[model samples]
Target: MAPEYLLWAAVLYVGAAVGSFLNVVIHRVPLGESVVKPRSRCPACRTTIAWYDNIPVLSWLALRGKCRGCGTGISGRYPFIEFITALIALVLFARLGLSIAFGVQFAFSCALIVVAYIDLDHQIIPDKISLPGIVLGLLAAIPGGMPAMTDAVLGVLLGGGLLLTVAWVYERSTGREGMGGGDVKLLAMIGAFLGWQGVLLTLLLGSLLGSAIGLVLMASQGADRKLAIPFGPFLSLGALVTLFWGHAIVRWYISYAGLAEI
Candidate 1:
């Protein structure tokens, strides 16, 4: 009801719209297709979606999640992505207010959303997203940016290098690739925005959370240890958690370890 809440709601709505566009990029970029050349169409029938059907979450609900012409079943992922993007935008707005930091965080969040789903479905992270993201993030780290340029560069190196080294060692020892290039790039992209401390935080948090989930999955009857689980989602989760709670988490750890002056 308040003006601030209304502004946040509007931001979320815009974010949802952006998510719809991102869906196109996520689906096309990995396949070596131009995301801009063709407008959105139904995969089932190649019918160009009408403007009415393309209105983010509302259209999906209105159409009952089916193509109007071919009556094809639409994946719920469409609305789900929109909804998640909206939620993330609202949260970021609340945390950062209306500022450049909010814009940077919003862009980073959208990238993560796309990367998370693409990696989950295809087991690949497109360099198209990560490589450009690194450059953009560093450019954003001008004198007035969220982090200094020095921090941005260090973050990129630390995030990518640490993962790359571990991946190499794991592969050499086990004769299996324990990490993918995509994962390395994703971390590097995240580091560009959050800096080196964020990279370390993301790694520690992601590993702990991922290991727990893996343990739970292994205990389940239908799960196999050999089954590959995409790391992008966990990395995204870690980056998000770090974005909101990194300072507090670091302070808590230091105090718990008696390493901080009280």
Candidate 2:
């Protein structure tokens, strides 16, 4: 009932609204459709969604995940995305408060969410997001920003270079393309925001997470060894982890490896 609680609630509400918009981005961007012109609608029936029916998680719950006009089942992913976006916003607010840092990180996180979902659905990370993101990340790294500008520049180079090198080597060694250019750009964008150190950690974390999940899918589902899984989501997850705990993680690793003095 306190003012802080009220503030948090407002933050959550706004976050969910943003998420709703993000859902539009995720759905429409890949198809080259304008996200703003067309209002939200029930894809099943082509009926325009009413404002009340479009309320973040609540509307879906009210409608029981079905179209009000047609009773067609709506994907739960809509609400899930909304909820996750809200949670991400809350996490950022809690960590960074209402500061420039919060705004920067929130925008970065939203981009990741959009990239991740788009890649999952289409196996492609659109340049529309990552290319501009690289520029924005560098801008965010200006004085009093997340990472120092020098670090951000290095991050761009190293992030792009590291992935590119790996992708090139992988293709040459296998005589097949093993990675996409999108992954390289995505990392570069991450570097712009988090710096070269963050990029390194993000790659380590993303690769490990991707490999582990891949192995699980192969084992549990008897999936193909050559199963083509999209890597953007994993990278996004890694970036999020780094954004929140990169410093602590690095310190822990240094102590664990007895490399604190190295």
Candidate 3:
């Protein structure tokens, strides 16, 4: 293989390793556990995982998806997360090459991966992730950076403000908390990374995709209007889509509307 391909392969491997660590964070952070204090261990047997057994996807396959000490079935999510992280890293590398853009995109992808799973499982997005993410995103938006600072600031305001307003109105109208504070923070994080344009795109695309999923779930008797669906995952998806294809999507929409390009 070419030298560049080899380098990317190494990067992907590292990303997979990071994904394994991220799994620990995702699982423990929400439970108010220290992700750093404890080394990797099998949840079933509470046995410290040997270095070999901790290899990202390979270890899962080698162990036949079971704990070595107790033969308990391991969660498939471990390997799945590793695979997704590797794939995302490869994609970002291909798109942005070896640059700051690559780092920002990779960081965003990793955050989304953690947010997606955590929200799915617990319906919560920890301040540890979202709050730090907001600050990091803004820092990433420094002038001449991946996203301009102006854009980042606008995104932060638009994303957080819009969600906060909607949540407030919904609560007032219904006399209930309709949206979680976590959702607002998550969007703010997205805006910090993607900017105001991205914030708008994320909200638009997220709503469309979320609505479709809700409709499908309702039709299948899986969910209903009364059922609470975590909005963080859908917002993450929208942000990811915007990160990669925002410009093209915006152009296509404008052209379809018979408007001149800005």
Candidate 4:
């Protein structure tokens, strides 16, 4: 067997490659564009990116975050996402190795990254990612894992149902749609992978983070409390945190609240 560190390096490389692809997914999925066809090109000049220039973060850094063809400044986000993906792979590989758990969580993390960024830009969570994500999450459970199939199934139901209910309630009370259908689907997709407990945690954490940021914006820039803000990134952050340290976090919370015996 390969040394553990070597295996980790390989996983990180694979992660970087997937991150590169995810960049494409983030850009194209919301626009109803195909990710597979049409080679990566410079947006400024329509020049096809060569293999050497497409080496994920490395290529971006080497090119000084500029389009090699047009000399236009490229987004630093390209390299940042690749680095984050590599870091994620390193973490998951160190924790779960190359087993089914690692593969399943990797896919889950990739979806989160894509959906988070796309929603940040467009405020929409495309069904292309979330719906299939729901099915894949359930299927991953069928093979035996951390999240039991029952847990995954319940997570999907609870995640989607809870949000739908909230959306319904808010609309009735406020006479306006407070949340989009995309957020509901996004949470459902998260539940499919992380389970019901994860869904609960994501809701709590996402709400807290979203509200905190919203308040900060309002206080600093005169933003209205009702100003629209994206919630998917916060949910994504919560799911990722739960995936790595949820049990410990839950236990800590219970103990802190003097409910450990319960």
Candidate maximizing TM-score:
2
- The parts of candidate 1 lying over 4 Å away from their true place are 1-6, 221-223, 255-262
Write one digit per residue (lDDT tens) for candidate 3, span 28-86: 98999998887988788899989999999999999999999999999999999999888
Per-residue alpha-carbon lDDT of model 4 for 1-262, expressed as tens digits? 8787787778889989999999999998788889998899999999999999999898998999988888999999999999999999989988877788888899999999998899899988889889999998988888566589889989999999999999999999999988889889989989889999999998998898888888998999895867888888889988888888899999999999999676
Q: Which portions of model 2 miss their true places by more than 4 Å?
A: none
TM-scores for all candidates? 0.90, 0.96, 0.93, 0.95
Q: What digit string (tens of lDDT, one per residue) describes model 1 on residues 1-262?
A: 5777678778988989988988887888888898887888899999999998899999999999999989999999989988888888888888888888888888988888888888888989989889999998998898889778899999999999999999999999999988999899999999999999999999999989888988888888466888688899899889988987899999999999999875
How accurate locally is residue 246 in candidate 3, as Cα lDDT from 0 to 100?
96
Worst 10-residue lDDT window, candidate 1: 1-10
Best by lDDT: 2
Ranking by TM-score: 2, 4, 3, 1
Residue pairs with backbone overlap in model 3 = none
- TM-score of structure candidate 2: 0.96
Error of 4 at 129 (Å): 0.6
Q: Candidate 2, residue 50: CA error in Å? A: 0.5
Candidate 4 weakest ten by summed lDDT: 138-147
Better of 3 and 4 by TM-score: 4
How much is 254 displaced in model 3, in angstroms? 2.4
